[model samples]
Target: MCRWAADLGDAIFLEDVIAAPSHSLIAQSSHAREAKSPTNADGFGVAWYGDRPEPGLYRDILPAWSDSNLRSLGRQIKSGLFLAHVRASTGGATSRLNCHPFTSGRWSFMHNGQIGGFEKIRRRLENALSDDLFDQLEGATDSELLFRLMIGEGLSSDPYGAVSRVTSRVIEASRVAGIEPSLKLTAAFSDGEALHAVRYATDDHAPTLYTAAFAKRAGRCVVSEPFDRDGRIWREIPQSSFVTMTRDGTSIRPFAPATTRWALAS
Candidate 1:
C-alpha cells in the first residue's frame, strides 16, 4: 500500500498540512488508520512547485516520520501546488528511486495502487513507451512506468484522456496475460497549475481518496485518507471517478475507463 497528499492554492508551508493536522500524514506513516498496509516505511518523496517550471524533488529511503531533512524542508518550502507521498513496497526492493511523486518536466505524480501481475506485464508496458520516456524511467515500480506512459500519452494537454488511454491499455494487457485484478489505482497528477486525480480498479475496489477543504487557507487538499477522523472535514471521492481541484474549486466526474469495465461486467 501507498499514501499521498496533494495541496493546491496559495503558497503554504508543507508541514502545516502534512505534519500539523490532528492525524497528520507523518503520523500515518507508522500507523495508518485506513490502508491495508499500516506502516509505509519503505520510502518517501516530495515534489513542490515553486518558481521554476519543474518542481523541486526530494526522495529518500528513510520513512517519512523519521526523516529530519524532510521536516526541515517542509517548514521552509512553500508552494501553490505540491505533492508528498509515503510508499509501502508491494513486492519490489526499497530504494529511493522507487519513491512516489515521480517527476518529469513540469508534471509530478503520486499513486496508491498497482498494476495486477506487474512482473508479467512490466515488459509489455515498457515496450509501449517511446524512446524518450523509456530513458526517463528511473524506478522499477509500476507507478513510475505509469507516469511515463501518461507523459507519453500527452499529460500536458489532456490529462484525463491520457490516463484513461494508458490505464485501459494496462488493464487489457493484464487481461490478455490472464492476470486477475488487472489494475487498481488512485492517483494525483499536477503540472504546477491545477490538480487532477482518478480512482479506479478492475476489481471494483479502488483505493480510498478524499478532499479536505481548507477555507482558512483558501485551498484544497486531495489525500489518500482523511488527515483527521472528523467526517465533516473530508469529502470522499466516489469509486471510479475523476476529480480536478483548482484555485477556484473542485469538480468530480465518472471515470470512463472504470465505467467501461463495469459496463462490460454487467
Candidate 2:
C-alpha cells in the first residue's frame, strides 16, 4: 500500500499540504505511520489544478524523502485543488511512468490499494477497456489500469457510477481467478472541480481514510491518514463509504459494490 493526500478549497502553496505538516506526505515517504510498511520509497507524484482545464503534474522515480525537486515544487507551486502520493510498490516496477495521480484530459486519480491476483486477472480487465482508453494507458500498474477501467465505464460523466461498476467488475474477475479478498482501496480523484473518494474492500477490512476541515486554514482535505495527531483536526471516513468534497462542504454516503453489481445485473 501507499499514502496520499487530496485538498480542495482556497488556493494555497502545495508545501502547506505536502511538506509542512507534522506527518506530511514528504515525511511519509520514509516513515509512514499508517500504512502496512513504514517506508514507501518506490516513487512519488503530485497533481494540481490551477486556471487551466488540465492539471499540472510532477512525478519522479526517486524516493520522496531524497528528492530535492519534490521539495522545491512543494514550496513554489500553489493550487486550489491538488493530490499527492507516495508509492510503495505492491507489484509493479518502480518508474516515473508508474507514479500515482494518473491523468487524462481533465481528470486526475490516485489510489492506495491493490487489485488482488492482478496478474491472473490483468488481461481480463485490460481487455474490457475501450480501445481509446486502453491505448491511453502508459503504465503497467493495476492502479493505472483501474483508472482506465473507470474511464471505460463512463468516468467522464459519472464518477460514482463508473467506480461502482469498476469495483464490481474487479471483484467478479478476482472471484473467477479464485483469489480471496479481491481488492482493497481508498482512492481519490478530481475533475478540476469537485473531488470524489471511496473506501472499500472485498471483505470487512478497508484501508484507512480521513478528511479534515481546517476552519482557520487552507480548507478541507482528504488523506490516507491524519496529518497531525490533533483529533480536532480530522474525522475518519467510515469503511465502505463514498465521500464528496467541494468548496461548499463535504458529504459521505454508504458505498456497497454489491448494490452496484445487482443494479448492473438487472
Give the top-scoring candidate (lDDT): 2
* Model 2 ranges with Cα > 4 A deviation: 229-232, 258-266
- Let me know the TM-score candidate 2 reaches against the reference structure: 0.95
How much does candidate 1 score in TM-score? Answer: 0.94
Give the per-residue Cα lDDT of candidate 2 at 212: 87
Worst 10 residues of 2 by lDDT: 257-266
Give the C-alpha miss distance for residue 134 in model 1, angstroms: 0.4
C-alpha lDDT score of every prediction, in listed order? 0.86, 0.88
* The 10-residue segment with the lowest total lDDT in model 1: 257-266
At residue 247, candidate 2 shows an lDDT of 88
lDDT of 2 by residue, 1-266 (tens): 89999999888899987888888998888888888999999999999999899999999899998999888988888899999999999988998999998999999999999988899889878878888998999999999999998888898898888888889888877766667647898999999999999999887688899998886664799999887765436789999999999889999998877444321121
lDDT of prediction 2: 0.88
lDDT of 2 at 209: 97
